[model samples]
Target: MALDSNENSDKSIHKFESMLKTDDVYFFDAEDFEDIIHHYLNNGKVSLGKKAIQFGLQQHPHSVELKLLHVEVLVFEDKFEEAGKWLDELQNIDSHNEEIYVQRANIQSKLDNHKKAVELLQQALELTDDSFDIHSLLGMEYLFMDDYEKAKLSFMRCVEFDDRDYASLYNVVYCFEFMEDYDGAIRYLNDYLERNPYCEVAWHQLGKMYFSKQMYQEALAAFDFAIISDDSFLGAYFEKGKVLEKLGKYREAIDCYETTIEIDDPTSHAFLRIGKCHEELGNDDLAKYYFYNTVHEDPLLDKGWLAITEFYFRKKQYKKALHYINKAINIDGENARYWKKCAEIYSALKNFDEADFAYKQTVDLGNFELDTWKNWVTVLQKTADFNTAEQVLLQAIEFYPEEAILYYQLTLVYLASDKPHEARKKLKSSMELNAEMVTHFKTDLMKYNRFSWITAIFADDKKASA
Candidate 1:
């Protein structure tokens, strides 16, 4: 009889404890709910946190914590105007609520009102007696402004108040890195590694810093540690592959790019790096295959076409280069740069008529480079359009008066028109300008290297005089 009575009493006690947990406390405990909401917000559970806060708001309709949390939730959702509206609500609820003003300041910061944010933070500093988060927030505002030195000071204060939080310490490492204070970054990162050996972001950052300083071996060590910290670390793989390439380990670099591609990232730049590695290994056919795949896979990538064109251009295959350049130009017909490239390849093949037309189109479509215009003149001379050719040469001279070769070319244009005296005068002027070309070459003044072209016109003089 006594054992049964004891069991029933224990069951009742358990039931009452469960009821108390489910029931709202008679005493207002807004801080407890605020802390819970903050935890969820930081952990990316905004929806669940919002729901919990809504329930708390209903329980305590006049609580400043509820309104502040609502504003924070709106900010997390990127509803800036809605956040401002709630911020206004918070200020109205109780103008004397110091926490409400600080929360409003946070919303203003999110709205990118830096001046107002600083003013509010300063005011909050006095009200909260220089609270650690307010100082951190000030530092964060400066950090967003890329003020690394001031950001470092803010993070330092954060650590002083709460030494256990890793985030502020992490900011210190980042600030040092951005400031180019590499020694300080390395020292702090090493110290942090003692407590957090698996901090992949810090390790990855250290590798990048050392890499920039050309400390290749040390960079490799840091990247390797970062990769080991997280096996699926794509950033670490990219860094490691870059270092490997610098070390002339092309094969290893190729493997790393392949692994990154296998991770199924559709927008992977790994294909680009992999193709370059194949090109370095003297497997141009394989390199071309990858480049073509990259182009077809991501049809909008200009880099893919550029890679394909460069491969053949490097191989001295002008026809193959022209084919790809034309294809690239077709995709973006108004792209003057591609048209210029097409014109260049045509010039290389001595297909001057086509090259001139392409260059004209390039200039028409907004290419204004001196080199492009000079290329135009060279193509025109090859095509025997001395009239058009002279105009282009004059444009070059007009822009660059010190070019003696341009004046020399102008003399050729006059001689082509059978005006010998005019040609001689211009030749003398060209020699005066350059001085080094006075006795250079006799036969260079002919159009397109076909010196015999002048004879057909001069033959008329021979008949008339006879």
Candidate 2:
């Protein structure tokens, strides 16, 4: 039976508000003042927090905790000098107090002296018998410095003192991720589970680490334990479903996803995944229904619109694909992938001008791949925009100098513009990069007389062998 601190805090707030309404002399202990002020601060009502501290100080003038909180309020208001003065006075009153050291460390952190803050917190850790908060603060300072290994050790110390410190535990896992030591994370979580086997969150985190490493079976087992520890944990179900999907267990994955929807409200992600699973299982109608449900659940989810668009495109419903992609673009016009998709759909429908515009937008948004540049150049050639195609190839060669295919394609553009010297130069560079792609180049371009330069290279290769 833990204390219902929230209920107590609510009552305290109500009584304080009533006292304010009636102008009555309300009495509250230092702890009550702390809670009331903390409630306001946590809710972003900093003004109200300051008022609480001011009013509480009127009654308990000698309350050191209230004075410390007053310093915090001053700090929050960006009154750093006042906060420092108050901290100095408080240290004189209680030189050995951990809270004073913590406050000073916070001020140092705000001043961008994280190294100084770490030293201050380390001193505080020595002064305190229960150093959970000190360890947590030190870990945050180390994290700010990008010393992930030290940050992880500090958070591990915090978790050792208090296994219920879920935030510190999560930070420990985050530090592991920052270090890219997934094996270390798995070992740490396994050790933590040995101590507190019923901690569902730790199990869930373990599952996530395994999933990242692509150990799908191990991830599935971890998620199963998470669900067993807390049957109502929707995250475990969702994660397990993802692992099942990776394992190609589509029916099992669908069941897990369905269970998540049953235990919690429907999510756009869940609905979309369900649709994908149904599609894999060869149930197009059910897949369509779930895809529709996905957008209905969250109209603003770009993924849902993208999924619906892909579904229509696969079915060769070009008009419907175009409609859905337009809807997606309208929602997130800056999304490069959406523009790229739109370009592909338009190209399939032979809407050359629209496809060219979409491909241009894709490039402008920095969402283009090598294929996008190739497609754009192809469209330009189809529309007899040879000058623009040459310009595009010139720019593309600068970005993709290592790609033999780009140089090969550039040779064609230069030959078309009657720059035979430049064409031969580009052809020589292309052969040097990848002589194997000569077959592909020949198959695509051998019809034109300009392609004679490419054949001359092959002739030279054969002569060298002879």
Candidate 3:
């Protein structure tokens, strides 16, 4: 019906355009002018739409509809004040015209007056028998107000009016998901599927809901159904692979990911996931091949480079790991994970200076993990940079004030720096925080046993505890 209407409008539009070309006066009815103006406006030909409206108003001087179209064009051009005045005049001429109220709502929505927009849409809903568009608009207003329940209800009505309204269906699901009602989303999608059995989108969404809840078998079934409904559904194939991975079916997961590549162009994400699956299945050669493909497909993808770096690192190929990690850091120097990995690879290769620099970068990039601080301090100590090691431990203590290990490590730093007074103070603090950590301190203290004053302090603490 809509296509036929557009076709009919196209004929009127052609006639109107032909008349304009020949300086001929064409006589068209008010409805034909409306269709011609609407065709131009819908196709984004605003100047032509305005010309049609001018010609239309000339022919049908009392046409409320053409005047309303003029108001719509004004609103589209963001001439809200003029549009509002025209709407007011048109409403007085035709008090019950729903388009006036809808146009008012549109202007209000554009001005960020969502509440007023909702009230105006409510008025339009009362005046119109077909309320799908009004309901959709109300849903958007409710969403802007963060009223998920009302938004859900409005979009649900749209879905009920037209089950093929996938946009409204997605909005309904979004409302449910935002409210954290995963079970409700699953139930709603299941009910919708009962009425529309071949809805691949609903099936795919249902799969995601189940996946969020860790219902792997159900998610797998839903994704499989989505694929059955539409064999070339790339999203379903990709999600099915993720579910298979969670189920420890690596080979099957690889096949599902491979199917997505066959259905469409290969994405770097797919290549990366396939590489991970092959690695999990102990296929190093295939993993390496796909990992390379992943980076080649998208050099800017930090994950791909990190994956290749970690693969080599796990194999104890520190040189290869360092090489790839440098590339990853170059791609995303701000990424703490990349810097952390770079630090670890340098440490594995016993490059203390470079490792220390990478560790400092990792921390500066806001990675305050406990092991990050600990590893960074250890690198400084390895380089015999006692003063820097002391400063790093002091900073780590600020982050982990109650951590006994940090205090104990600080005590080690003090002893290394030949500060007996500071060393004893830190040792006491560590003992108070956690006395059991003293044993680990003792193992580290073996090198500093020449400091008899440190030995005396330990003996005094042990005696006091006894």
Q: How many residue pairs clash in all the candidates, one count each?
A: 0, 0, 0
Model 1 TM-score (2 dp): 0.60
* Model 3: per-residue Cα lDDT over 105-174, one tens digit each: 9899899999999999999999989888889989999999899999999999999999999999999999
Cα miss at 248, model 1 (Å)? Answer: 1.4
lDDT score of residue 127 within candidate 1: 75
Backbone clash total, candidate 2: 0
How much lDDT does each candidate structure score? 0.75, 0.88, 0.91
TM-score of each: 0.60, 0.88, 0.75
Model 1, span 1-466: residue lDDT tens: 0011233234433433354477643332565555556655666777756865776686778877777778767776788788777777777766665666676677777778866877787787777664787887888888777778988888878876876556887788778877889888888767767867887877887898788788999999999999899878888888899999899898999887777777657442577777878898998888988888888788667778778888988888999999999899889888888888889899888889989989988988888787887778778877889889877777777777887877777887777766677777777788789755733534455343343533443455569899
Point out where model 3 deviates above 4 Å: 1-5, 16-30, 33-77, 325-466
Task: Name the better of 1 and 2 by lDDT.
Answer: 2
Better of 1 and 2 by TM-score: 2
Rank list by TM-score: 2, 3, 1
The true-versus-predicted C-alpha distance at residue 383 of model 2, in Å, is 3.2
Task: For residue 67, give model 2's deviation from the true position in Å.
Answer: 2.2
Residue range with the least summed lDDT across 10 consecutive positions in model 3: 1-10
| 1-466: candidate 2 lDDT, tens digit per residue | 0112466799999888788789687899888988888888887888888889899999899899889889887776678899899989998999998888888888888888999999899888778798877888899999999999999999999999989999999999999998899999999999999999999999999999999999998999999999999999999999999999989899999999999999989999999999999999989999999999999999888889889999999999989999999998888899888898898898999888888899899999995488989989888777767788888888887788898988888877877777788878888898899988977877555555455666665676679889
